[model samples]
Target: MDFKEKFSTIKKHLLTGTSHMIPFIVAGGILFSLAVMLNPEGAATPETGWLGDLASIGSAGLTLFVPVLGGYIAYSIADKPGLAPGMIGAYLASQVGAGFLGGIVAGFIAGYVVKALKKIKLPISLKSLGSIFLYPLFGTLITGGIIVWVIGTPISAIMEGLTGWLNSLSDAGKVPLASILGAMTAFDMGGPINKVATLFAQTQVDTLPYLMGGSRSSYLYTTNWNGNCNIVSSKKI
Candidate 1:
C-alpha cells in the first residue's frame, strides 16, 4: 500500500484496539493507585500484611497485562497477521520493565514490520519463509533492542522516582498529617470533610506508598461512617 494507506491502517488499528483496552488500563491504574493509597507502605512483596497483600494484588493487575495492550494494538493495525509476533514483542517489552509504552512501541514496530514483510515480491517458497521465520525473527529483534536499549532505563527510572516519592512522605510528617487525616475522615462522613481527608490520604499515599500503611485501617472506620449515616437516615425516615 502507499504511505497514506499504510498510515490510515495504522491509525485504525490503534484507535480500535485502544478503545477495547482503555477501560482495562484505567481500572488497573486507579486500582493500583488506590492500593498504593490504602497501603502506603508500598508492599514491595505480597507478605507485608493483609493491606500489603491487597495492594500487591491490585498492582499485579497493572504489571502482568502490560504486554496485552501492545499485542492488541498490533492486531488492530495489522489484523490477525500481526497478533502472534506483536504479542511476543509486547511480552518481551514487559520482561525488560518497559511497561505499556514499551508495549506500544513493540506493537507498532511488529505491526509495521509484518506489513512491510508482507509486501516483498517473493515466490511461493520464500513466502512461507517470510511468514514463519522472517517476520517474527526480525520483529522480535527490533522490538527487543529498542525496548532494552532505548526504553527500559527511562521507564524504570520513572517508576523508581514515583516509588521513592511515596516512600519519603513518612519522614517527619506522620503525626500531624495523621491527625489532619483522621479529623477530615470524621468531619464530613463522606462529604466535603471526607473528601478532604481522602485527598490528604491520597497525597500521602502518592508521596509515600511504602510508609503510610495505616490508610487501609481506615476502610473499616470509613464504613462506620456509612453505617452511622444509615442510622441517621432511618431516624429521619
Candidate 2:
C-alpha cells in the first residue's frame, strides 16, 4: 500500500479500537465523577458504606479501561484470536505504569503477532490446538514479555519526564500548554482531537491534577458556550 493507504489503514484500526473502548470510558467516567461529586468534601472514607462501594466500583471500571481498549484493538485487527493476548499485554502495560499509550502499543503488538502466528503451518492434528491453546498462550507470553521488558521502561521514563517537565513549568509556560489542550478539546467536541486531548488529561490526572482540571474546565466551558449559542440562535428564528 502507498503512504496514504497505510495511514488510512492505521487510522481505521485505531478508530475501531477507540470506538469499542468508548462505552467503557463513558460508564467509568460517569461513575467516577459521580463518586467524586458525592464525596466532594472528602469526608467519606472507603469505610463510609454505599458511597465507598460506588467509588470502589468506579475505580475498578476505570482500571479495566486500558485492558479493554487493548483487547478490542487487537480484536479489531485479528478477530477473536487476538483478544486474550491483547488484554494480557495491556494489563501488564498498566501494571508497569506505561498508561494508555502503552496499552495502544500493546494492542497493536498483540494483533500483529497473532496475525503472524496464524500464518504458521502446523500438522492437521496440531492445527486445532493452535487456535484454542497455542495462540493465546504463546501470543500472551511474547506480547507481555515485550511490553514489560522492552516497551514498559521507556514509556514509564517518558511519562515521568513529561510529568516532571509539566510540573516544573512556570504559570506563563502552562498557559500556552493549557490553551492548546483547551483549543483541541473545543475544536471538534467529541471527535478524534477532542478524545485525544481528553484521554491525555485523564491519564495525567493522578500525577498532574491541575492539568486535567484545566482541560476539563475548558471542555465544560466550550460545551456550555455552544449550547447557549444554539439556544439563542433558535430563539431568533
User: Which is the leading candidate under TM-score?
Assistant: 2
lDDT of 1 by residue, 103-195 (tens): 667788777777776777878777777766776677667666776777767765765565455345545566654554555565545444454
Per-model C-alpha RMSD: 12.0, 5.9
TM-scores of the models, in the order given: 0.48, 0.78
lDDT of each: 0.58, 0.74
> Which number leads on lDDT?
2
Cα lDDT of candidate 2 equals: 0.74
After superposition, candidate 1 runs with Cα above 4 Å error? 1-11, 20-61, 155-237
TM-score of 1: 0.48
